[model samples]
Every structure is written in C-alpha cells, then in structure tokens.
Target: MGYVPITPFRRTAEAVCVQRARVQSAPAPLPVVSKWDILSELTEARAAFGLSDRDISVLRALVSFHPGTDLGADPAKLVVFPSNASICTRLNGMPDSTMRRHLAALVASGLITRRDSPNGKRYMRRSRGTATAFGFDLSPLPRRFAEIAEAAEAQRSLQEEIAALRETLSLMRRDLLGLLESLPEECQDAALTLSEDTRRLLRRKAGLPELRQREAELSMALTHVPPAEVISTEEMSTNAAEYEQHYQSLKKESSDSEDDPSWYPMQSDIPGSENALAKKKAEAIPPRIALRTVMSACPSLNDYAEGPIRSWSDLVRTAEGLRPMMGICRASWEETKRHMGQIEAAIVMAAMLERFEEIKSPGAYMRGLSQKAARNGFSAMPMVLALLRREGTAQYSPGRAA
Candidate 1:
C-alpha cells in the first residue's frame, strides 16, 4: 500500500468522528401526527374538547383504561411511565414511531403524568422518569352521565303519571255530574246527605236542580190569587128590575101627595124638578170611591202583587216607592236560587264520592274496590286488593250498600 497522504486521511477521520459525536448528542426530532389521523379516533371526551374523531376516541379510551397516576413508574422501567400493558398490547401492531406519537399525544392531553420515581438517588437520575394512570380517574364520568340520564327518564315517567291522574279525576267528575242529573227526583233528599270524602271532592260551586223547583213554587205562592166564582146573570137582572120598580113608586107618591095645605112645590113649574132631586142624591156618594173602598177591604187580594197600600191615594204613592224595592227583592230571590242550586250540585258530588268510597265489599264490591285501587296507583293495587279480601261486604267495602 502507498504511504502517500497519511496525515490528510487522519485529519478527515478525526473530523468525521467529531461530526458523528455532535449529531449523537443533539436532541431527537419530535413526532408529527396529522389532523386527519386524529379525526379517525373519536370519543365523548374528545368530542367535548372539539378534538377530531380519531384523536378523542383513541385519547379517551387510553385515559379510561390506562389512566394517569400521581407518580411515574419505578426506575427499573427506564421511562416516564410504565406503559399500560393494555395500551402496549393495543399498540403493538402499530409502528414504533406511531406508538411514540400516541404517547406524546396522551401526555399533551394531560391524560398521563410524568415524574421522578420515589427511589431515585440522584437529582438528575436518567432513570427517575414516571407517569400517572389517566384511565382510572376519568372512567366513572360516563357512568355518572348514564345515572343522570336514567334519573331524568324516571322524572319524565312520573310527570306522565300525574297527567294521567288529572285526566281520570276530570272524567270522574263529569260522570258524577251526569249521574246526579239522571237521578230520581224523589231521591233528592237522599242525595243531599254527604260524607267527608264527598265534601272534599265536590267543592261548594256545583249547583243542582232541586233548588230551582222550590224557588218556582215559592214565587207562585207569593204572586198567585185564586179566582172567585161569580153568580149567574139571571139573578143580577131580577135584582135590577125590583130596584127600578120601587124607585118609580116612591117618585109617584112624592108627586101625588097634596093633602097638606103647605105641601106646594117651590119649583112645581120646572120640568126637571124630580131629575134634579135624583142628581143631588147621586152626587152625595160617588161610585168610583165606593168600589175602590170595597176592593181595599177584601182580604183575598194577592199581597205579593198588591204590597201595603190600602187606599187609592196610598196605592199610587206606594207603587212609586216600591218599584225599586221590588227589584231588590227579585234580585235577592234570584241570588238565593243560585246559591241553593250550587248547594244541590255540591250534595250530588258528595253522594258520588260516598258511593265511590263504598268499595270494600266482597263479590261485586271487591271487584269494584280492586278496579278503583288500580286506577289510583297500580303499584299499590295488589296490596290493597289483598287486604280487602273477599271475605264479606263488611271486610272489603267501607260505605253504604250498593
């Protein structure tokens, strides 16, 4: 071999060695993961973070199953964290670079913790690296979410039950009203008797029909008058003729009388002397006054129609004063009728409630009791049915006999 350029070769080898040493001492390049790659892995946590699908799915699963811990692994592992066995298993198929990139992503996401192992002897110990398990801490959030969802569903169901109960109660009220309307008019007295349960259900405003009838009868009694039977026309004619004959005889006797010497008429030459005498007697007592006096004296007149006026003068004055009073009385009567109607309706409602309360009997009663219990609360239905067994009507039902 030729010995030429030996110094130059030594110098070039030395320079190559320095360059290699510099490169070896320099920090390694950081791994890069594309947004598209992250988008492929999605999970609830990552979606909340607005991370891509692939990123969140991979990240959340990693945290849930391979959670971070307070400290990294022991120095024996020679890494910041002892890699999760499950993660390692899942990532085993991936290239080393990709696996390293995933770990960096987990670290950046705060899913893993890096620390020095407790057994470290030196402050700058290269083997002091450790990481936390991110999976354990975040694992229960999903379960909590599920529990909240289930509770909301239960609330919705309860709301539905309450709505159904309201509808049933409304229907029951309507049915009770119809029954009251169709009830026998003679049974009104029976229907008015109320139980405590019935009172609670039918408040005071429900008006009924019986009160209206009584009001009608009262109005008629106050305002009506029985008509008097008049005599036949033949008897009135006979009385009129007899009075005329007696009057003519008396006039003739007065004119014919001339026995006494001083019986001369002062107006004997006047043609209307007898007529003038008759007119004077009629003027002394007016027919209008006499008829009014008789009508006032009669006790058969309708007091409600007549009021307290006795004389014609008093009647006219009192009528003016009583117009408003009569109006007030009529209004009061109407108000009383309205209130009484309300009371009747309330009583009917009470009756229905009492009937419903009588559900503790055997056979038909027991069947009804079960149906009512079921309508109220199905969960308590079976227990109520059992307690109210079909031993007898007394045992199963609580109210009047059907």
Candidate 2:
C-alpha cells in the first residue's frame, strides 16, 4: 500500500473545535455603569444632609421597592427622593445632625438638588431615561454644560410644538368627514363606508338613494303573480301552432285601426317631455367653494423661511400653494381657521404650562441627575474648587473654617 498520512482537513477540524470550545468557556464582559448605581450612592449620602441613617436607608428602600409611586408625570419617570422625615416615616427613624450635612455635601457635589415645596424641601433624583439617550462626555465641561442647557430649552419648545400639531391634525380630519356627511341621504351610507375619497365623491354626485332602498323598490316591482298557463316542452311546441292562429286574428284587427291617422302617435309627443327648458336648468353648476387650508404645521425656527416676506406672509404664500394641491374643500376652511386659532391658543397655553412645569421638568431633573452622577461617578468638588480655589496654581478644596 502507498504511504498513509493524516489529512490536513482532519487537523483543521480539530483546531476549529478547540477554538469554539475555548470561546464558549470564556466568561462574558462586565456590564457598563448604570443610573441605579449612581442613585444608590446618592441615597446613601442622604444622612450627610441632616437626615438620619435610618432615613437614608428608607429612601433607598422606597426607590428600590416602589419606583412607580415616586415617579409622577415625568417622561423620564424618575422617582423623587423623599425627605428625612418621610424617609423616617417610611423606614421608621428620626432626623440627625449629620444627615443634613451629608445632603449638603451631595448638593455641593451637584449630585442632587434640594427641591422646595409648599410643605417643605426634599431631595430629588432623575431616572436614566433622559440621560442615556444623550451620552455624557466630560472632556469639555464648560461646553458640555452650555450644550446641555440649550438642548434642554429645545426639548421644551419641541414638546409644545408636538402638542399643538396633534390638535390641528385632529381638526383637519374632522372637517374632512363633515363635508362627506352633507351629500344626499341616498349616498350618505356608502359615503360613510367609502375608503377611496374620489369614489365617495362620484357616488354622492350620482344622486342615487341609499343602495338598500333602490334594491327594495326593484324587488317590489319584480314581484311575481300566478302564471295564466303552464306546459311541458313538447306540449308548448304543439301549443305554438294554436297561438299563431290567435295572434293573426288580433293583428288583423290592429291593422284595420292603424288606417285611422288619429290612432297613431308621433315619437316626440310622450308623457315624459325632453325640452330646451330642462337643458338650461341642467347646465348650471354649483358655486366653487373657496377653501382656506391653513398650514397649521408650525415650521420650526430652523426651517422658518427667511426673506423680505419674512413674516407670516411667507408662511401664508406657502399655505396657499399647499392648499389647492391637497384638495381640501372650502366648506372646511372655517374649521381649518379654527384649528389654527386653537394652535395659537395652545402655544400661549404651553408657555403658561412651561412656567409651572419648569420646577418639575426632565431638564431640571436631569440637571440634578447629571450633577448626582458626576458627584458619584467622578469628583466635581475637586475640579470646581480647583477652578475657584487656587493653591499656587492648582486650586484645592475650600476647607471648612475651624
């Protein structure tokens, strides 16, 4: 036999198996830092603000246990951190001197803010909902802070715009439906069921009464009466001979009557008259409805058209061009106007809403959350004091005066 040797394919197969086994045995990488970790650390320091250790423990437990109750209307759905007393009530403890100091340190570090209420002040924390979407980069602290402030402002403005847009779109749909309802009652049912807008229009224009009524009238007219006679196929053939003889006798009588000119009738003179008078009446068309479809979609400031026609005039021209193209009927123009008026009212409403919401908005919450995260994840006190307190060149922490 020829010299036998191990195939290269066998070696490759063994290597592949070993590699996959090694990969499967390897452990997964550790998870990235999350908001919960930062929150936990913030809660732990509640006592530094004059809250008791027990109060701090209670707060930690509430957020961990009942996250939903703490979160109110916030989109981020972050739970508000409870106060020392609330914490004590929840976890069963009393306030202490060091609790307030811890909270002050947390505040100083920019981890959390002391929120004021009609009742009193309490610490607030933000959930990760808003922050994770925006990745945190600390390289340019000053620039980042400025960007964050601007982004927060933009978010507020966008929310107001979204609410207004929803209201206007809803009105436009309502008006479109109302126009379809004004057609003949015959067409009203099908019009209501029609999905193709053009088909619905044609049906309304055709002026047919409801399909069911038409069907009923046809049914009554077609109702059957008892037959005068009945015959089998062979019997009908024999009867045809008899019927022809009878038909000729009747025809002879009609032929004699036809000689009298008075008995004949002209084609034009009939019960239902077709004339020029009716033709003129049919020619007239309904007046064209002039619709005003206001482009209630408020163009963003970035998208706001710029020029000499820079004001609402530019927007009006844009609206004029879009209206006819969209085929909105004039009957709904009033509704469109109402929609625009409502939107303007909403903008004013939003401004008022914002004033009250500012204290509880995600931006403010995130501002506190960012500070908290910065405090826990990194040391801002050293950096902040370094900038404020210069020791030779490097500023150190501003130590308490003994």
Best-fitting candidate, scored by TM-score? 1
For 27-102, candidate 1 gives per-residue lDDT tens digits of 3432222222222322323523334444444444454332233112221221223345545565445454655466
Instruction: Please give the TM-score that candidate 1 achieves against the real structure.
Output: 0.19
Q: Which 10-residue window of candidate 1 scores lowest in summed lDDT?
A: 1-10
| Each prediction's number of clashing residue pairs | 28, 21
Question: Candidate 2: lDDT of 135?
Answer: 13
Model 2, 1-402: lDDT tens per residue?
011111121223345434433342233332223334434443433333344454445335434432332222232223244445554555445454545554444333333322233234333333653322111111111212333345445644544554443333223223222333234445433432331222222223121234334334323322321134223445533332332232333433322321244323334324355533332332232111111111111222213234323433354444444433333223222222222222222222222122222222322221232233324431111221111111112211122110
Q: Candidate 1: where are CA atoms >4 Å away? A: 1-141, 184-327, 330-402
Instruction: State each model's CA lDDT, in order.
Output: 0.31, 0.31
- Residue 166 accuracy (lDDT) in model 2: 32
